[model samples]
Target: MMGNRALLMNFMEKFLETVRFGNNDFAVIAGYGDVVI
Candidate 1:
């Protein structure tokens, strides 16, 4: 059970990182919206 919990935590951390990266990419695009349009 402990090992499974550790694995789940590791997966959660990676998922969070991916989510953060996606948010940063979205913010960058929104910031440049005026020029993009």
Candidate 2:
């Protein structure tokens, strides 16, 4: 469970980075992701 949680956090960081520095479309997805989280 701890491993899974760590992996998820890592993925979230990378995805959030993409939203911040990559593209606008991903920001929309990341916004929804934030709501879910």
Top candidate (TM-score): 1
The Cα error of candidate 2 at residue 9, in Å, is: 0.1
lDDT per residue for candidate 2 within 1-31, as digits (tens), equals: 9976776776677677877786868766765
Off by over 4 Å in 1: 23-37
Off by over 4 Å in 2: 24-37
Q: Write the per-residue lDDT of candidate 1 for residues 6-32, one digit (tens) a residue.
A: 766665565566567777665555445
Alpha-carbon RMSD, each predicted model: 12.9, 4.2
- TM per candidate: 0.57, 0.57
| Whole-model lDDT values for every prediction | 0.58, 0.71
Clashing pairs in 2: none
Model 1 poorest ten-residue lDDT run = 28-37
The TM-score obtained by model 2 is 0.57
